[model samples]
Target: MSKKWSIAALVLYVVYAVGMYFYIFHGASGGVPATLKGTVADPQTFMTERELYLSDDYSKIRNFLFFVVTPFEWLVYFLILFMGISRVFEKWADTKWRLFKNGAYLFLLNLFTTIVFYPIDIYRYSLSKEYGISTQGFSSWMRDYVIDFWVNFGTTLLIVLVLYWLIQKSAKKWWLYAWLLTIPFAIFMMYLQPVVIDPLYNEFTPLKDKELEAKILSLADQADIPSDHVFEVDMSEKTNALNAYVTGIGGNSRIVLWDTTLNNLTDEEILFIMAHEMGHYVEKHIYIGIALYLLSMLVGLWLISKIMPWMVSKFGRVLNIEKVSDIRSLPLFLVLASFLLFISNPISNTVSRYQETRSDEYAMELTGDAEAAVSTFQNLAKAGLSEVNPPWLVKIFRYTHPPMLERINTIARYTDKNEVETEQQAE
Candidate 1:
């Protein structure tokens, strides 16, 4: 009887694994069917004005599949929760029940913390703790958090509602309509984010060192980039991580130097870092990225709408919901989204890795200081506690940037030509 039971358990595990593999990798186009097409609209045409050409019959089928697939995806989350519980019990075998109780307690603790934290903690603990970078403390952090939360929450709700209305009211081409709705919101977010949203986290002060500022501006001028001001961001209030970036689009674009970056890196390293960021702008990577993301989201939403209905019927029975859009049915929707994200993680990582490499190449060309670039990456690795080497498959599937060793090697190959030549000369 025990042997039979053991065999049954093994079979169940195999079935579960097989089901997950298909759900993650094969569900969308492999087994399920859907059609998606984009219109050839004028580049200058506003997204709101464009129409996505999708078949009406396909739309109904897509909605049905979305409902069907949702519950299987939610089961994945249930499995995760179970595995987490099991791991905790294994770690505290002597007090297994106590550990479970503690897990419950921690969940409550975090829930309570969300009421007081979330937006404010973004400043207090995130920005202020960086030694030279962040000067913010508890009181200031609290004030910033509260104001940011309400403002951001209100803005997000407004955007979501507007988008939902656009989808419901506009062209039968929902994807096209959704894309149009996204354009103004995207522009607004880009403009308001740095000026209004960022200030809630850190103080932005005009960069003080005229000489350094002049040097940076000179570099930008030589690159034929137009910018009016450079500002120092108080990132130290939140994290010790050093970073710098050029952000915004068109006329709103600006260079932001993190206080942590200013504190830790040499001017040459900073210059190289800025050069990499500039590469993103000069190469039109930012615009390309935005367009690519919007397109991908449209496709994903279309796919989801197809699978969601069948997912709902299957999972809804468990959740006691009759329809997919029932407010109580949100957990099922969340589960489906999670499954889709997990399945798409590798694809997303590959795209990002390619973009990062291209940007790195552009940066190297601009800075012409491969050694400084290499050193900058090394410093980042040390600061972030990043693993220097990872398995090739792991890196390919999971990494946004190339592994530290690979980046270092690439830079070293370019910078160490003299050492290679010296050996050849001796030979």
Candidate 2:
């Protein structure tokens, strides 16, 4: 067999074995059947890892579509459309939309792009619904999209203006200045996202289950995280997928759990997941991610500063752009940014997977309940319809967390070691 496919088969076998162990254990113990718990509430049940993870033809097809669609979105739809628009408006390039031709083009560019690409977005959402992941209605999805569009509209407008302003002021070292400015600007945006922007999409409230809240807070306390920052978001409106995340920076930072996760998981499982999230805050991964991204942007902007001038000389007239900052140059600017983003994906994902694996260990250490860690991941894999082992390319390019099989194995190893140590102490 080919190496990649062989590796895929081996990992998939691991997933099946682990899943079978859980199914048999739960069945024998009379632990809550997934159906009774409303965990896998659909009529089409997943009984084994092959069924639960590997055998989902819909998800695999959709994922493959994503591998195709993303580059199309970035390189084709986003790029070619803008290029076409600029050429179409060739005469008006300098004078037609004179007032709106500068920084305002950022907003117009995004609006046009989103409109052209909105079908792709909706098709993706539709696929999620078909696969039983999304619970959102079409109208509700559109409403959220509108809110997202305006948010982007505002941010893109500001980013383009500042970028251009830097370009005009310092022709030679503008990229360096902009790169430095991006660090603060990026952090400032992160600080605002949880507070100002997230509220528009979903409702957030202090977790109402007091006993559960206290347990979560205790874990936070153990981790030296502030108790008040843990909030539960109403995610059941939009999705059935389980998740928790830490967002914002400094005082604005908060830990958020999807209500879907709360409703689906046991309290013990929930605690382990929350502790894992707390580890992110404890480790300051958000800051680390921001720093890494800004560092990449520094390199990306510098490269653009070098290459953009040359592109302008070649395609300037066709693109209705005179220089790097012409606002009309936004598409080409994104071309460079997107290329950098594509290459950086694996690097960033590798760093994230390391942090995630460490956080898994941290949670195991904090809770010392290996069973809960195992169960937590098992249920999460089921909840999200995650392929416990995707193909090799997907693992490197797509996943930010280690596969479910690897995570379960990691916890089992730690669990086994702990038991051995206890037995030694007893002797």
Candidate 3:
């Protein structure tokens, strides 16, 4: 029965993955309209044919990887579970010292998973290198990869320690307790990420362009964001892609710009982008996002608590998992959580798109420069090689912001509306 279930699941996943690949690569249509010609949003007008080709190639491969990676990771965990590799790690970790035992198990599991996925990581790096998207040397990239591995392992260890402790304390309500603990832990991580974590990979310094800094500070003042610093990160060493963001909370809160952005965009376009990040702050999107995540985690954990036990009851003997609380069952928890998160991508992405739309609108209002807004989007699309309009499934699963086409059109419409209003007032 377990063999049948596993086979059935694999078949379903293969069908779904292949169907999505064909739908995106073959069935997807992104034909441009005649009206878009000569507009800033028009790919044919704006991007060279070589650029367009690279964009299409990168998009297809990226979409394919997105469809494949999570399911493939789940299968890896399932294989480990099925073959009792996790149990082997558990036995090897059975030392007299409790701390040593727990740490050893976690380290072994993390190491195994990281090793298995290293090839995929290298392939991703090679993909970026091939397309001229990444600028980092292989050594620097490997350093970052090592940093990520340790960071992930450390966080996983912490969470597992807390979770298993809770489970042992109260099997009936451990998920509830874990959820409560996660709220503060999540906030704490956000608070520290800007100060303690981000500097590990790249250097960040105060914005060098004092004139532009003053302008950004003025926008921050207008937005009532109490930020005194604008950060400029050295991303030229890593990638050619342009990016900027608002990060941290309260005292740590600051606006960050990639050096590539500063080098590529005009002051006006930069101001529009800065205003958009400020808009996220003014609209309190970060807090709202945290709230939504906590709500989802609350429900997700509760569901896992109910479903995991049932799954163990049905398939424990086949999979070699003794019970929910067994240390060997960590992969099972990860699989369930991953599945839940994957299925919720559309909902989470929709909320993100909505917030981003609001920020784009606020940026238009705050900057009062429709031309800058449209040009900023155009430059962004060009620098990133982003398709103006991706397929709907891509938008649903992947896009946090509105499509480039939608963004530019929204700004154009806003400009037209304002011009009509001005004409009415003059009459």
Best by lDDT: 3
After TM-score superposition, what is the CA distance of residue 321 in candidate 3 from its true location, in Å? 0.8
Model 1 ranges with Cα > 4 A deviation: 1-152, 163-176, 391-398, 416-427
Candidate 3 Cα deviation (angstroms), residue 368: 1.3
Task: Tell me how many residue pairs clash in candidate 3.
Answer: 0
lDDT per residue (tens digit) for residues 1-427 in model 2: 2234335545655565455444333322212335334333221333464554433555466556645555555554233433456444333434555345554555556666787888878888988887778999999999999998888888877777777778878878999988888877887888899989999999999888889988988888989887574789999999988998878877887878899999999999999998898878778887788878888888888888888898778756654567765555667778778877877788988999999998998899899888788777777767677766555556677789997767876787788899899999999
**lDDT per model, in order?**
0.58, 0.73, 0.89
TM-score of 2: 0.83
Question: Candidate 3 regions off by >4 Å?
Answer: 1-12, 33-38, 97-99
Using TM-score as the measure, which candidate wins?
3
Which has the higher TM-score value, candidate number 1 or candidate number 3?
Answer: 3
Ranking by lDDT: 3, 2, 1
**In candidate 1, what are the lDDT values of residues 375-401, reduced to their tens digit?**
788677545434444434345545778
Q: What TM-score, to 2 decimals, does candidate 1 have?
A: 0.64
Give per-residue lDDT, candidate 1, residue 221: 78
Please identify which of the two predictions, 2 or 3, would achieve the higher lDDT against the true structure.
3
List, in order, the clash count of every candidate structure.
37, 0, 0
Query: Higher TM-score: candidate 1 or 2?
Result: 2
